[model samples]
Target: MPALVRAGTAQQWPQALAVPGGVARLSLGPAAERPVVHAGDIPVLVLGDAIEWTAIVGIPLAAPVGEAEVTVQAAPTAPARRVAYRVAAKQYREQRLTVAPRTVDLAPEDLARHERERAHQQHVMATFSTPLPEGLQMRQPVPGRRSSSFGLRRVFNGQARNPHSGMDIAAATGTPVAAPLAGRVIDVGDYFFNGGTVWLDHGGGLLSMYCHLSRMDCQVGDVLRTGDAFCRVGATGRVTGPHLHWGVMLNRTMVDPALFLPA
Candidate 1:
């Protein structure tokens, strides 16, 4: 299992995980309304009622393993308060595979397509919505054996690639994938690497993505509640087989999806 570090007064979903590319939830006592918290310049999610407010911080993968902070502004007129957090180093294992040459070395046209998709997906993942969700607990989008591949440094055809950013669930082709939380469809497209993908904006810098889908039932701007079937699993993109690449993004950074999964 991947090591996790957590801190906070929150009974559920605590504030800080010192691990690089982890999440921190900060509790800001009592508020008239939801406060605005910034993890750097990006707005973090503030969730609460007329009572306490909490900020969900997404620690980046590149963040140095040490102390970090976020700024919280209770109201528009109020000054921002800096809240301290810690980030610890977590080592990920390396995996090597021998795949087809084409999969390892992309053609010029494929590379161009990937660049465009990356830009568009980045915008979609950065979406911040009003009326933040109350909690981070999420239902499994599909029923299958969860592969602990998150953060695995992958080498394909002797070439080092980026660490895996999402959790992979091994499932059969055409397996249904459901929305883990209420969200609006912000992006749906076919890409070079991700294949058919769907991005959901779940308000307040909390987003979810489903990739390598065989079919997409939801379109952009569509609203879906938890358990709504939005797509079917497939081996569309560059994949070994049919499975769902589920990702959770907080503050525009991809954190471990397992953090949001039910215990």
Candidate 2:
């Protein structure tokens, strides 16, 4: 089993950016044990312990620019209390691309495949485990120029779709991708939109995903340390070129991956 983080000395928390698609770190005060926290119905990642507890929340990109609250309970039978925070608006740039018409408008078979993949991926994303003892900071998985930023409103073939939910790193085909943090490989598969994909559970409702890979070296249940090479970059899915789509998810919401890295 992974070690538990010492209450106040070891962990390096992610920067708190209280905006849509950002992270909000709220203090939960001191308690005898780690508090149970939730943002609406989604379980949240809580760190620290008796000395001090903190709730790390991932604000969704579509969240309104206003106040939000989380419910916290020190114990199972303890009354839940609300902690409120503000989510500011952020304007991300837009990107337009011309991809194959087939990818933009999927056929019936492809649509069905996509729906199945989506359901499976959702289950994978919902995984939560014991909180990792190590710090929350992460290194870059693959060194390269950032081809695309997160939250970019994307338009393909003149049809607008969901905002870009991850950072795309420009790397050559077969460029090795590393694990940004120590984690357990929870899922690995080829998908309709994400292509060759790998999901890593970093524990405590924190997860990271790598997509558009040429190859995957790790399998489900593989434990990897930080900087372990686990895959290679590629243009496997509905992409214009070879790149890595790196996503960091907290509490089942995809937030800005940059918040976990050094500035």
* Highest-scoring model, lDDT: 2
- Candidate 1 residue 253 Cα shift, in angstroms, is 0.6
lDDT tens digits by residue: candidate 2, 1-263: 21121232224457778888998888777999889898888899887879998888899999998778888899989999888887778999999999889888999999999999999999999898985546798899999999999999999999999999999999999999999999999999999889999999999889999999999998899999999999999999899999999999999999999888877
Q: Which stretches in model 1 have alpha-carbon errors above 4 Å?
A: 1-11, 14-16
Model 2 pairs whose backbones collide: none
Task: Give the Cα lDDT of each candidate.
Answer: 0.82, 0.89
Say which candidate scores most in TM-score.
2
TM-score of each: 0.91, 0.94
Candidate 1, residue 39: lDDT: 79
Backbone clash pairs in model 1 (N, Cα, C under 3 Å; residues 3+ apart or in different chains), count: 4
Q: Cα lDDT for residue 70, model 1?
A: 83
Indicate the TM-score of model 1.
0.91
